[model samples]
Target chain A: MRPILISCHTRPVIAVKFNKDGDLFFTGSFDGKVSVFWSEPVERLGTFACDGAVKTMTVTEDSKYIVIGTAINGIFIFEVETGTKVKTIEFSSKIHVRDVEFAMGSQQFFMISYESDEKKQSVVYIYDFESVLNREQPSRRDLVRRDRDHYYRGVWGYLNKTIVLGTQNGIIDVVDTKTGELLLSHRAHVNQITSLAFSPDFSMLITASRDCFAKLLDPETLKEIRVFNAQRPLNSAVISPLMLNEGSPKYHCLVAGGQEARDVTTTATDQGGFEITFYNMIFEREIGSVRGHFGPVHSVAVHPRGHMFVTGSEDGTARVHILDQDYFTPAYD
Target chain B: MADADYIEREHIEATADGTYKITTHIKIQNKTVITNPDIERRKTLPKFGDCKNLSKGDIEGSINIEDKEVFLQKSSQVRAEENITKFNLNRAHKEKLDALTRRERAIMSGETEEQKTRRPIVTEREEFSVKVSNLPDNIDQDVLQNLFGTAGRVRKVFIPRGRDDNLPRDFAFVHFDTKAEAEKAIKQFKDYPLGHHILSVEMADRRNQRRNVPMSNRRGRK
Candidate 1:
């Protein structure tokens, strides 16, 4: 059990992000909007909107620009301080870029697209943003298309040492970033794995699945360190990286977004009703629970400072909350 | 090795022009002026059903609930003078009767609140409820929810709040979304012993008597 952060509202959360400073976090949902909030006060600093459902978000290592992924397959780069749209990346209709990450050192970034079908085939496209924009036919082709059997959902590129790939099979495959080769594959749940995160210090990889299991795994070898099967399906989980700070940065928390297993009769998982839950790893207990949505919870992203997190869910809501070790508090700023 | 594979010229269509005919090209008309909605730059968090909203917009609330057979069966027969369409009525009359009464605000709201308080207390979803009984003076809601959590899609599974040495009744109620789920759970757990007590998993008491149930045998509402 460990301390974690959670957020909930009446809408389905589509994406969540921790700004570079860890001082602020952002969230977007099906409602076609995004919000920035102060971690400590939990106040809304600003709000923005995209063309459609914001599917994913990636805050550059420098935190200069935030890349927002929309269900319409368009990526918008927004300035952190000014809340301005700096650039736009568009994809052809055939591809839906579901997740994106800025590699270590912020030299390049990667985006993965999930094809909505039973095959659940996907592609991994790597790019050096500035370098690719210089090309005449910039969107000529993807850098690499993943193989068929290796279906991937979420990607976490930490220090370029570990590449965490979540699969539709509820497994987390940690690959060596240097070699682009598989290092470890752990079956973390009985349902499709929805989201994963790597700690800032690169010691932990958190995995969440529709089977209701939120797991903490050893980042290096992908060993299952702890499993919190709340008996509730989850869509995504993100771990706060600032825990490595010696000053007791106040968070080593895991946030899971998902819902109660639907069709409990068939019990096939992916039932989709969910709550954003905070787990205290050291205590091995759930410290806080935020409930509001009527659908599945999807993503949880902590602010860089380890104080608060923004969560997304299928019910079309995104919520933000602050962490109070003594208890969980709502930061309504 | 020469004859192992004979490639046909037509099998692979060779392109002869600057670009293939099937090339994906974006045809753009030169525009002297551009016009679009100047909504917020962040395309998220719009008001429910705002024009700029994306995806399916917000959910329609809990207005749409699917009713399976078990939900109807366990709902009880209404027993006496109820306003619902009586059984043995023809299908057409039943439909008309249901449609007419569902329009009545008083009747409509009457049942909803009852449904909300589902179990004696709030659990997960309203359709299901769980309560515990016969504990040796000590037990908790955690013991009950965890006990029935693995059974099926638990809407709400918890032990109803009790008083000193008193039980919520010597029984627990486990509510599930679908009657099939409830039935599945009953087959697997009913009559099974949880410590010293035999669990009787059955359809919830009829909706009509749920309130008056305070007079029931064991943990009747005081």
Candidate 2:
């Protein structure tokens, strides 16, 4: 894999997400902008200015809309093609919007709100896009209330049926999206379960935790299959998208990155930079690592084509890695 | 009331532009203040009922004992023997009950000691607690216990959980046997990297010391 450094954000890059087509990717930064880039050409397409530093962001599967959230600024929904502001959602300014995830194959999106007011603290809400497009106030349903002691940082919709929330207590709370009934709750790690990424077939689920362990688990039973130790506090982990009929051995590989467990400073010159570890699902061993960022890696996203991945780091850069070596070599030749 | 007897009169002639002439007269009547001890004593008693006799009991009765002895000598001898046997039986039963109670108490105390050994010995000393912030999530209890144990005998390490999530909020209160030990830990571990973050060591604020302040609810872009 070859790394291409993208130095667009002036501050720490918090989020990196690729659209379904894999032609475009988005990077949100604490510099108060969400930069869009053409993946193949690796050129900056445009940048959207937010009211405050972007904390989290997501683009729809069809790439029709982009939703960005900030700590002080309200959530903004924009039409991707026209780059026009679609809607502005008003929430308590005290809230730190942590996760913005567009639902798979739907016009609905889920957002995890944290550090909010007492009335709506640590809540995950599902908002309908059709309502926002109609210029009407979007209808929302509260999927989970993570008040006080039950804070959740990550949420993903499983099979578009149930919503799975990764809690601060290292537990996963599976809730029925329609009925809002709690189906199951189990501890996935010892510390905060930071992120959850599901496989393409929806069979195996991977979880990253601040406990320095990334685990492969059965989504239905929430049973641990294997543990990949990172020896650091992982903030994000993503499973590579399935390679279509390619028969590539690297399909469904896990890439996880986060803070160094020992080195506390952000500007250490030694082996102190953030590390991205890759694990092969078939071989069940760490296959490789990516290290370049001077600060801790905050997030990682895999392209839909599974040829490349994007990683956002606290060092204010989002790096693009082309996973298929042949794709780059053929071009150089 | 203080006694006063006097008559005073004042007159004012009307000016040319004044409405009317005015005359005023003041008189004080002779009066005497009551200083009897009986009135003050009566005022202190309850007002609803008879003050002195209300506490006294009215009903009284007593039964007189008959001098006649119905039992003959043989019956009386049997009764006396029965009474002695019943008294001895009651005494023995009471003694046995006392012994059993004492044994139960001893067993309970023994169980308490066992429980004390089984339970974690966390000393309740708020003064000797040092607050440590920026703790990495992966750092387990044993690591913290060993780290803080070097300073002095750490009584307990309490990581405050979020109100709803039950997750440690990246800070812990380490209590030592003495304030000196807590101070030592603060001096040693301050700004040192324990896990993923540099430790911010300080004295812990008292429980509930943070007052509830209203958060600003300003919405939308300025």
Candidate 3:
């Protein structure tokens, strides 16, 4: 399938996410802007600006508000429709927010921040989403803290009772938000876990690590279910919603990453693995790959309906690919 | 044969390109005509030839004028003698040509009898060297010599480094005084824990000396 190339960010794009309805998608970049685009026609709708380079961002379940985390140790909330700033939360100058996500079905959200110091401290904070939306002081609390290994990504489990965090040491930690207790910790890979994603049904959690492995695990118990191995380090992985459908479904997963940015200058583009790879989720075999990005792909987000997916890359572009009809058939198996 | 009424007409004309165009027309009164019974009967009759009364084998034997066994035996005797002479001549010529080509090939490839019999010189240091790999990056030659000196009398220690960065690689070679001492060092240092990594020691294989050269100097030659 040919992808619709959306190039607006002036710097490398770090994150791309789709709304719950899959009608609109957003791309966050180091240029300090989050541009929203229509998923079907792939037209730029509007852009929200912040004061610092965007590290990560997440939209509310209703697609009404967006929370952006920036490298300047600030978290900015904006109303999606008007592109108006709603709230701004600042941290110490040395602390930069890495990831943020909304709770499954509540007025709460979580943010993972890391300190740029020798200790490499990481802390996860939970905020009351409604208060932030009202431009009031949001009730916040530290849910988890680490001094050695940094937490790169985190996602709420099931119904927000548990939060699954992926750490720098390839460890997946499941923490209870109410008690702030560590429930389970499992070493998911051999290197740092770069991203964490949950399947559409929230039954399985997929973790992408710098060790060139993406694994599916039971979110509650942290038990390994399946493993997808690649040649280069994987930055992001997403499971197709069609894989869990009641009708005829395709068991496919999308994984995107490439060689490290530092070594890209000395490596050839093709050999650097600058493409999104498709793997058979059940068989754990690579089916095919889509090549377009000139640099490493940093993030990939699939539509809720599984018909389209968007990839953000270090090439400063986000490509939206609407899957062809032939993808629905089980040809890879 | 049946007689039928027919009319025939012809028209000729000269036109462009200096070519003649002719048109012939025929009109038949009867749609069908009967064939001659006598001719049909003649066609159905069996054919008669000179060997009509002879059997199949008799006809074949008459056509073959020579005696089969005698002709085959005589031809075989002649061909066998010819093949013997040809085979001997070809064998002698091939042997001579093979030797000539072998000598030419050896000369082309710069291979002589002396070159084939000669062996490469091996120094005592190379024969008594042991390669230690998986060493810590911060390790130095002095530390390596001190660590390996317990096995035997250490002659020399060398650590390879990166050409561009000049940082030491993860391996080093230690030369002992004798082969037995080298073997003792290999046995003793195998899997020896140094820093956080285990050391792997083995006899140095000097067959490919290219690996011992620096990267920048080794390029463009092979």
TM agreement with the true structure for every prediction = 0.51, 0.57, 0.59
Error of 1 at B68 (Å): 35
lDDT of 2 by residue, B64-90 (tens): 112332110112343355566655654
Largest lDDT belongs to which candidate?
A: 3
TM-score of 1: 0.51
Q: Write the per-residue lDDT of candidate 2 for residues A120-193, one digit (tens) a residue.
A: 56777888878866866778888777664455565565657887888776768788888778888666666777
True contacts kept of 1: 0.00
Q: Which tens-of-lDDT digit does each residue in A260-311 have in candidate 3?
A: 8899999999789887888778776567777778889999999888888888
> Per-residue lDDT for B163 in model 3?
67
Pick out the ten consecutive residues of candidate 1 chain A with the lowest summed lDDT. A1-10
In model 2, the clashing pairs are A148-B164, A149-B162, A149-B163, A149-B164, A149-B165, A150-B164, A150-B165
Fnat of all models, as shown = 0.00, 0.00, 0.00
Worst 10 residues of 3 chain A by lDDT: A37-46
Q: Comparing 2 and 3 by TM-score, which wins?
A: 3
Between candidates 1 and 3, the TM-score winner: 3
Query: lDDT, candidate 2, residue B101?
Result: 48
